[model samples]
Target: MTGRRKQGFILFRDVMHVILAIVIIVMVVFAFLSPNKYAIFFPLIFLLFSVSCLLDAIKYFKNEEHLKYSFIKATIMFILFLFMLLMSTIGFLNI
Candidate 1:
């Protein structure tokens, strides 16, 4: 990757990390302040984490390093995302 592209990817990854952190904080706060609403954020948290993992996988693929690890992690995250989404939609999670 070119220097500029690599920098952009780094910036994007940083932004994702920040967003993920913020989401987790919000989820925790909600869990404490309003237990009933906490489940609402479950799927969203998983989705963000899965997306982050996907971004990492893409970055690894571009750089030709740790491809298997990144892809495997992304796959796991996506599965969790899907499972959470299903549970939420089915009322099993109470979201």
Candidate 2:
């Protein structure tokens, strides 16, 4: 049923949230301890961040009960992620 499907998606979104959080923490620590190796994981970091942004956008679209700023925040995050990704690809990051 639709309810079950929605619940499943919610569960997935929650998992993604947790995974994104962990990835961020790891990325930060790795950056501080091993800056040279951090660039190697930039692609994976980009992927995870993209997924997190996507899940937020999908959740916001599916459930409009959230505040207006929530959508704004999600949109900003998505744009920032894309910008960072593009910059990284162009060697602007230099990290």
TM-score of 1: 0.61
Error of 1 at 36 (Å): 1.0
Task: Please report how far candidate 1 places residue 59 from its true position, in Å.
Answer: 2.4
Put down candidate 2 lDDT per residue, 60-88, tens digits, no spaces.
65765687677777777668667656645
lDDT of 1 by residue, 3-91 (tens): 89889978988888788889877876776787666666665655555566556555555655655576666566556656655654555
- Candidate with the greatest lDDT versus the true structure: 2
Q: What is the lDDT of residue 42 in candidate 1?
A: 60
Instruction: Give the TM-score (vs. native) of candidate 2.
Output: 0.68
lDDT, candidates in the order shown: 0.66, 0.72
